[model samples]
Target: MAQDADDAVDCGMTVGLYGRLRPYPWTGGEGGADDGGEELRERLVNLALSRAEAYDWYAPAGLRMRGGRSAHPVPDRWFLCDQGGADWTVGEDETGPARELLWMRADLPRRIASARLPLLPMTRTASDALHRAGDFRLAALRAHLPLHVTAGEADGDWEDMRDWFSLAAPAPTVTVRCAVAVSGEETTPPAWRSGGTAAEVGAVWQTLLGEAVTVAPGAPPATSAAGGGVRYRPYLEPARPVAAYRCRVREWTADAAVWLLETAGEALRRTGHRVPVELTAALA
Candidate 1:
């Protein structure tokens, strides 16, 4: 989605968005006594440096935090940072949580993503999107470059990446459509309750394919450099990577895990448009 506001053509560059939001009664230091403001700021700075993928767009103006204090004058159109990575924007006041939008474009052109339109944030929600866009895979194939992909820290991605990069495989594409809903006061499945505690601004989803989805009930409210704060849900574990072509796209809710947006979008868009229906997701 690196195109200008009007152009939908994605020449294989990527734009990813991740969010960080905590309800009032905010308890800031989740990272023990060491989780002070300076340490947090350094983390965000280093993360932006890695995620920015360039010095030009970042060097001149550098990063800022929306509604967060500033030393010098804030840049006109700054890319801000937080626990969930960096975001590209006009630095609008956070409508909800502090979300970061990440853009990763390669030094050279690979292939135009077959998506007729530039992809959306929701389309690129899977964990892999955190590394690269699906279009880049196809672009590699079309450009005749060897396509190399990595799995997640967890096994989900390892299994997902087993597919052949080209469209000429026994089953070239795999997609997961998650129907996430707010768990509400209705007890989250016993397995999903956090030490019998529930979370706020919480989002939950079940595979539309009739599979079980469980949040990391006892995993505690975990904070990560990659994902702000997450309640793990082991949903995308692929039984076998080469099993299907038909994908039922996931539905998104406003309250869902903003970081998971990358995982969700990457999961669905991994299809590389080989299937009849090129699966996609939207913020709405």
Candidate 2:
């Protein structure tokens, strides 16, 4: 009985920490940026380190390997390729062949999850600039500006143009909690728990409500941009101006809320914005 209980605990611990470790995207060629490669690499490193700290903080006490060691061990010294070189190659030596030696522990997954990378702060100056740029973009859009105009043509003003671009923005995220009742007792039926999948839950709930229910995946939390702020090119067609413009705007605004939130959050992080626990809870 004791051995069975220990096995269960071990399984739980492994399940809890399995996906918590990951390599930084920039560690490989797939994560290279078009511009500002150096800056992006630095941010990626910082983000990885920050996520590591977060993982440690939120890590379960029982999360350990069979030998009571940490499931993910951090190295004493790490290496980051700062010479615009390819990914680090495995070698026997401590320095290996990597260019820059980062004298920090390598805990990539934790760092990525921690989101400890700094962002360009949205200062008074920067905020004013963004507002001005947004106004300019709005004017250009109204004037049927050509899509080729690359200056300040990004979709950063979705918040300011919510009313103008109502069709583009997605509906606010709504979390609903409910209990199933059978006669006087509340209980979930076997069908609902067959696979314990969201599809089953939705089907069961729709049957109970006697109406079709839309089951869409939740918008995942946004992450900071590796190179620059979240920017998307504008799609404009002057021939069918309203129809074409509206279609593009709708697509842009559909994901704007979440993207904007992430962009603002990253900026705030760079500016050292800290939220109080009580306030965060209240807002949530």
Candidate 3:
């Protein structure tokens, strides 16, 4: 179960504190059962909110990409990260009931006062209600997420994800900037991996990006088929594989990605790309 959630994490958001909760718990070698219904949903959601409160930051990359950001044609999976630790997969087989969960972030006081730092959860009914009938703050939190977009599924324990927002339609004559498929050895990173402060992650991301730009200073031969760009596969623990994020949110991820791709790859010897660059150092 935890392994499955790990796979989903690489589908979008890369490193940091991330988690996924199944409606019901799972038994050994068996899939998740929806033994609990709305009552269970309420329990799980409450757990998620508590978890969100513990983290100081939340990245909405996938929430926007899938929910409609054209640059990210391949929609990223739903995930929440606090910029420390590995992915948090909640289930009977994994971390049992959110109560017993151990996270990478330290329990500290809020650093940003008078700021909307917590990622609150909003019910589907509430979001669709007449005039979003609920706390006014929910409207503000909508920009970020934890948008309670849970839905029923036959495979309850599996990576059951639903859209948090309805995406807008794209123009008929639209142009795609890039398309990619990440294929490599995928595995769940240990809890101790990349357990650094958000600042540490930022510094590493920026430094590596600077070097990557120098390595591939020239542009690749133009291609309408859509190819070329650095890919980062973060190894949370020493030489351990943290899944590649399926998100293309741009900006926040750009520099961090370069760092994980080149520097982390060489150091860990665990990252690679579908497109070969040895023939040429690389191209921007």
The candidate that achieves the highest lDDT relative to the unseen native structure? 1
* Predicted candidate 3 versus true structure: per-residue lDDT over 18-48, tens digit per residue: 1233322331212322333333334333444
Q: Write down the lDDT of every candidate, Cα atoms only.
A: 0.25, 0.22, 0.23
Off by over 4 Å in 3: 1-34, 54-206, 209-284
- Give all TM-scores, in the order shown: 0.22, 0.19, 0.18
- The alpha-carbon deviation from the true structure for residue 203 of candidate 1, after best TM-score superposition, in angstroms, is 24
- What lDDT does candidate 1 reach at residue 208? 16
Which runs of model 1 end up more than 4 angstroms from their true locations? Answer: 1-11, 18-100, 107-284
The TM-score ranking, best first, is 1, 2, 3
Query: How does model 2 score by TM-score?
Result: 0.19
Give the CA lDDT, 0 to 100, for residue 212 in model 3: 24
Model 1 residue 250 CA deviation in Å: 11
Instruction: Give the Å shift of residue 122 in candidate 1.
Output: 15
Clashes of each: 16, 9, 4
Ranking by lDDT: 1, 3, 2
Q: Which ten residues in a row have the lowest lDDT in candidate 2?
A: 11-20
Give the alpha carbon lDDT tens digit for every residue of 152-257 in model 1. 2323432332221112232322232222222122324221232211222112211211222222212221111112221122111211111112122232222122
Query: Alpha-carbon error at 158 in model 1, in Å?
Result: 7.8
lDDT of 3 at 81: 39
